[model samples]
Target: MIQSFRNEKYDHKVEILTPISGQDHTYALLATYEGLAEMELQNKKMFEDEEYKELITEFFLQNIVQGSMTTQLFRTMTGLKKETNSQK
Candidate 1:
């Protein structure tokens, strides 16, 4: 984990997060990747292609729990904490 501070109304300093320290993250990645693969293979032109699905999986695997509202969909999936003003 890493701790950093932001110049908020107060010192927003804290231990940020402890990453997945074992194979669970890997399994979760594989599971989600497979789901994307299934969608790409079966679903039509409304969405994903092989390359696009690969890109999505890559992003998901790289940051399962990012601290940003723009990544809302991912936060919901990974159960990431709610974003605060300081986090933004």
Candidate 2:
């Protein structure tokens, strides 16, 4: 799923990956700014709380397929394309 939101005068895109095997959910948000870069550089955080997972799940559902081609391009560049393909 993809979601777009404006931050710091630049539009940011979020891509959420929900695994079919019940693994921890992962997401990547991309934007043309240092803050986004910093977020990407940070260590991955996994959510064990049901409420947190539900919140994130709802967010992803609302934002699904709402992003532009550029977001998809970034997802590809970030290696999610390959990961998606392999998962299928």
Clashing residue pairs found in predicted model 2: none
Local accuracy by lDDT, each model: 0.38, 0.42
Q: What is the TM-score of each candidate against the true structure?
A: 0.23, 0.25
Kindly list the per-residue Cα lDDT of model 2 for residues 1-88, writing each as its tens digit: 2133223212333444565665344344543423545444421221444544666579767765545324432222443444466687
Model 1 lDDT per residue over 10-86, tens place: 12222233347764433221112134454344435313356545655676677766643231112125657999999
- Top model number, TM-score: 2
lDDT of 2 at 45: 26
